[model samples]
Target: MHELSLMGDVLALVKRDAEARGFAEITRVRLLVGDLSNALPDALEMAFDMYKAEGTAMLASEAQLALELRQARATCVLCGLDYVPERSAAAAMCPVCRFPGGRITEGEEFKVLSYEGR
Candidate 1:
């Protein structure tokens, strides 16, 4: 459902790039997906099949997904302590010096690392 829409968006972006760069045929697509990014690789592949139907790019294209694991970061505003968050804990707090809320600094990103075509 959502993956289909998401795949549509990705295909649109890729089509724009292909047209702008004069890529006649897309051979492969390489994507680096962050752990926090709400995308399932399997679902994306399935969605790609549905979205890219009857397209030039679809005839020779396939999406290659690379999952990126991100470490949770917690930055203490009170003491400026930067530390990795524990997976078991719901929220990460400063271990050395207790802080009310340690600001989360990373783990939210989705991007296309590379696309090979033409």
Candidate 2:
């Protein structure tokens, strides 16, 4: 899965920053994963575990991964209605006015929120 490479990139970035700050090992990582981010949380976790199992030097033996799921949200301009959108839908649609052009307000995030190292 692409999550393997994605997690690799994240860990590399964290390792670089943490080492620059004089940290010896990464203890935790927190990610904000939106529903529409196209990155699977389970796959990410598996990738993290694989890295940990490999005994990566920058990762602590008990390193933890925390994924904060963000729900997809959209707002209809025609009806002024805000609602959650289906993750697999091609476009955001408003339930109230049945508008097919609802503007997405959130849930496209796929980033590292924070990392802990020491």
Candidate 3:
């Protein structure tokens, strides 16, 4: 769905980096996805495949894209306790004391891990 557009952005970023780095071919692209990021794993991969078929004229048609998800975690603002909250309250306040606002310690990540090119 929207992952298609997200993937396009990712590919475009890689293409720009490759050009700036002077790499003629990009062999691999790695992405760091968070569980709470709301980005689906399967859909992201499918988007990459679609982009490859379109031959963006930047990345090699055979360029590989890897998506890796990180576990979701949060830290309690009041107790300073760290735990994984349920999907329902990931962004809400701490379940225990409901004190300070829940801050995401992990997950909710979308980044390029690494890229291999020549």
Q: Which candidate has the top score in TM-score? A: 2
lDDT of 2 by residue, 1-118 (tens): 9999999999999988998999989999999999888899999999999998998748899999999999989999898899997655677878787888789888889999999988
Better of 1 and 3 by lDDT: 3
TM-scores for all candidates? 0.67, 0.94, 0.85
Off by over 4 Å in 2: none
Model 3 local distance difference test score? 0.82
lDDT of 1: 0.65
Considering only N, C-alpha and C atoms within 3 Å, which residue pairs clash in candidate 3? none
Error of 1 at 109 (Å): 0.7
Which of 1 and 3 is ahead in TM-score?
Answer: 3
Cα lDDT tens digits for candidate 3, 25-89: 78889999999877999999888888777777366777887888899888887788787767775
RMSD to the hidden true structure, all candidates: 3.3, 1.2, 2.0
TM-score of 2: 0.94
* Candidate 1 lDDT over residue span 1-118, tens digit each: 5877776776678778987898876666666554445666678777766554656344363534344555557788889999876656666678888665778787555566667677
- Local distance difference test scores for all models: 0.65, 0.90, 0.82
